[model samples]
Target chain A: MSEPQILIIRSVSFQQLDQNLPKLQEAFPGARIALLTHAHGVRQAEKYRAIHRVLAYPFKEGFHYRRRAADMKREQFDAVVIPVTNLSGTGFFNVLLFSLTIPSKRRFVCNMVSDIWEVSASRIIWMGVRHLLFQAVSSILSLLLGIFAVLFLPFGLKRLSKNK
Target chain B: MSAPLVSIVMLCWNRIEDVRESLNRIREQHYPHIETIVVDNGSTDGTVEMIQSEFPGVRLIRMYKNMGIEAYNIGFANARGEYTVIIDDDSFPAPNAIRRMVDKFEADERLGVVAFDVRNFYSYDDIKKEAETTDTVTNAPAANDYFMSFNGAGAGVRTSVLRQIGGYPEEFFLYNNELDSAFRIWDAGYKIQSFPDVVAYHKYSPKNRTSWRAPFYYTRNAFWTAWKNYPADMALRITIQLIYSCLYYSMEQRTTVYLKAMWSAFRDRGRLKGKRKPVERTIAEQLRVPWNVNFTFYR
Candidate 1:
C-alpha cells in the first residue's frame, strides 16, 4: 500500500498529543500527520514537530464550519485518529462529531494510556443512537422535575417565610 | 489625581508554582495603587504556606474546604479597591493592563466591568515570550462589542457595581457564574466591555483535561443563569435551546453528563427564588447571541 495520510483530532491537551502521536507514527511509518483542533488551539498545535499540517476548526457554526469540514473531507485521509484522554466520561463529543463528518478509510480511537483501537463506523453510529435514546428518557424525567419545582416551590417558600 | 486602587483577587487550590508566578506578575504591575488578595480553597499542597512566606503583603483567606468559585466572595468582601480584578491561580494581568482597565472605567461612568484580552498558553515559556514581545496599545475596541458577559479568568469589576449585584451566585460553585453576574450588572444600568489592549495570560494547564465535573457544572449553571436573569419568554426559549444542545451533545459523546446536569439544575432551582429578577427587554436583546454562535464560540 502507498504511504498513508493520517489525521488526528485533538480537542485539547498537548500532553495527550505528545503521548499518542509517537505511537501513531510508529504504527503508520512514513505517514503524513495532520492535526485538527479548535481555532484557539491552532497556534499551540502548530509548534508540534510531528504534524505536517494544522487545520483549525472554526469555533462558530454555519457556513464557515461546514465549508471547512467539506474541505477536510476532500483531503480523503487514509486513517483518522481521535485522542481521548478520558474514556469513561462523556468522550469529546464535538471531536467525535467532527471526526465522523470527515471521510476516512480507517478510524482509530486512542486514550491517554496509549491504547489505540480501530472502531467500525457502524458501531459509532450505534453508540450515537443509544445516546439519543438515553437522552430522550432523561429529558422527560428532567422536564417532570422542572414542572414539580414550578408547581411546588412557591408554596414551600411561602411557608418558610411564614415560619421566619 | 491619585490612581484609583485596583484590587486583584485570585483563587488558588494546590497549584503552587502557577500561583507563585501569578503573584509575582501582580507585584510587577505598573499600576501604582493596588492591593492583592489570594483565596486559598483548602489546598493541601502547601500553597497557603508558600503565599504567606513569599508574598507577605498579600491578604490571604483560607477556606476549610474547596468551596469552588464561591470562595471568591470572601476575597471580594475584603477588597478595599474601587475596582476588583478577578483572576484564576494560573492567570495574571500584564504590567499596564490594570491601568488601562482603570482608565476605561474612568472614561465611561456607565462601564462596570473591563474584561482583559485573555491569552491562553500551555507553557510558561510561550507566555513569557508573548508578554515580552507584545506592544501595549492605549486605545482598543471591545473584543466582543455586542456581548455582555466578561470572562472570569481575567476581568475587572467595579466593586460598587459588583456589590450592587450581590456578587456571584454562591450556589453556582463554578462555571457560568460570570454570565449570572453580567446579567445583573447590565440590569443595573452598567456596561461590561473588553479591550484588546488589556491583556492577561492564562496558563491553561494540561492536568485534569478530561474531567466530567467541568461539563456537569457548566451545563447546570447555564440553566440557572437563564432562569434567574432572562425575561420569562427569553428564558423559556433559551432553556429549550440549551436542552436541545445538551441532549445533542450527550448523544454525540455517549455520556449522561448533560442529563445529570439538567436534573441537578431542576432539583436545586429553588435556591434562585428571590433572586429571579429578569432584566429588561432592551438589555436582554443586547445580551443575546445566536445559540449556535454561543455554543460553538464560547462553550
Candidate 2:
C-alpha cells in the first residue's frame, strides 16, 4: 500500500538489473529509493535513475580509510541492494549496522546474504537433475552415432583390412 | 656481516615516501643481521635521489624503465641471506617482523613459507586487533597474521625453495601471480603455512575504483588461473563461472565492464595456458573452496 526505499548494498553484476528496479518500483508505486555503489557500480546505477540518489563508493587499494568511514556514516539510505562479490571490509562492515539497515527484509539481505545466501536442499537437488539430464542426453546421442558408424565402417574397412 | 638472517626485496615505483617509511621499519629493527634491497621501479619521483641521499647503504637496483614484475626476479636473484622477503613498496613490515618469521622458518624445515598478519596500513591502529585475531570475517587466516600461505607480502620463504620454484611467476604481469606460484609450490611437494601472531601492516590507498584495466585484469586473470589449476573434474566450472558473471554483468547494465573483463581474460589467457599444470587433490576436498574461491581476490 506504501512505497519502500532501498539501498543497493553490495556490488553485483547487471544481469538482474532490469527486473529488480522496475519490480521494486511497481511494488511500491510511489516509493522513493536510493543506491550506493563502488567506483565500478556508478555507471550501472545511471540506467535506473528513477531512484533518489546514486553515489559511487571508491575502492582503491591505496585509498584513505577516514574518508570511507565518513562516507558510510554520512550517507542516508533506507534499503541497500549490494550485489557485489567482495564489497566487504570497511564498506559493508560499516553499513551492516546502519539504523535503517533492514535485517534481510530487502533482496540485499534476503537473496544476497545470510538468510538470502542460503540455498534450499531441494533447489540443489533440482539443479542436480538438470545437470544429469544434460549429461545423459549427450551420452545417448553419441552412442547412437557410434553404432551407426560401426555398421558403415566395415564396408570401407573390408578392402583395407583384407589388404592388411 | 653476521650472515643476515633475512633480506627484504621490495619493488617500488614512485611512492618515495611510502618506500622510505617501509624501509625505516627494517632499518630500525634491533635484530643485528638483516638486509633491505629496494628495487627502484623506474621512479621519476626522485625516489632514487632520496634513497641514495638517505639510505646510502640500502641496496638500490635502479632500472631505466618499468621491467614490470620482472624487477622482483632481479631482486630475488641478487638477494643473500637464508631467507628472502618479497614486499610491496607500499607495504611496511612491523618491528622485529622478519626476525619472528625467520625464527619460525628455522624452527621448522617443512615450512616452505611463513606469513605474519598484515593490517591495513592506514587502518592498522583501528583494525589491528581485528586483523591479528582469527575471525569469521575472513575465511582463512590472514597471511600478515604470521602464518599464511607463504603470502608474497610479509612471509618467510626459504631461499632454496624460491630458487627451486623460480620465485614469483614473471608471466603473471599483474594478477594471478600468487596462485600461479602457489600451484607450482604445491606441485613441488611442500606445505604452505601461515603464522597468525606475526603481524605487519599493509597501507593501501582508499581509491579502489573499478577503472581503466581493473575489470579486465580481475575477470581475465581469475579465469586464467582457474583454467590452469582447476582439477580436470572442476574444469567445466570455468564456463559456469563465466556465464554467471557475464549474465550478472549484463543484468546489472554493466555490459561494458563485463565485456572488458572478458577481453582481458582472452588476451592474457595464453600466458596462463602456457604455464598450466595439472594438480592432484582428493575428490572431496577439491569440491570445497580454497579449492576454488581460494585464490579469488576480487577487484
- Global lDDT scores for all candidate models: 0.73, 0.54
Candidate 2's displacement at residue A11, Å, is: 12
Worst 10 residues of 2 chain A by lDDT: A110-119
Compose the digit string of candidate 1's lDDT tens values, residues B46-79. Answer: 9999999999999999999999988998899999
Cα deviation at B109, candidate 1, in Å, is 1.7
Tens-digit per-residue lDDT, B1-299, candidate 2: 25446778898998888888987877776557778888887999989999999998789998888877778888888889688877888776767567667667767787777655554565344322243333222223222211113445666678888898888766655655665666656666665655445556666433533343444454555655555655544544453445354434333332355556655655555454345555565421222223222112233
Q: What are the candidates' individual DockQ scores?
A: 0.10, 0.04
Give a tens-digit lDDT track for model 1, residues A1-164: 77788998764345446556667778889998888765534554554566789886654332232335646757888888877655532444445555678878888887655668887778677776876676686578558655655565445434323123
Total residue pair clashes for candidate 1: 0
Which whole-number lDDT from 0 to 100 does residue A47 have in model 1?
Answer: 48
Q: Write the per-residue lDDT of candidate 2 for residues A136-162, one digit (tens) a residue.
A: 653555455445434542332232221
How many residue pairs clash (N, CA or C atoms closer than 3 angstroms) in each of the candidate models, in the order given? 0, 59
Quote the true-contact fraction of every model.
0.03, 0.02
Chain A agreement with the truth for model 2, given as TM-score: 0.42
Q: Any runs in candidate 1 off by more than 4 Å, and if so which?
A: A1-164, B123-138, B143-145, B240-248, B288-299
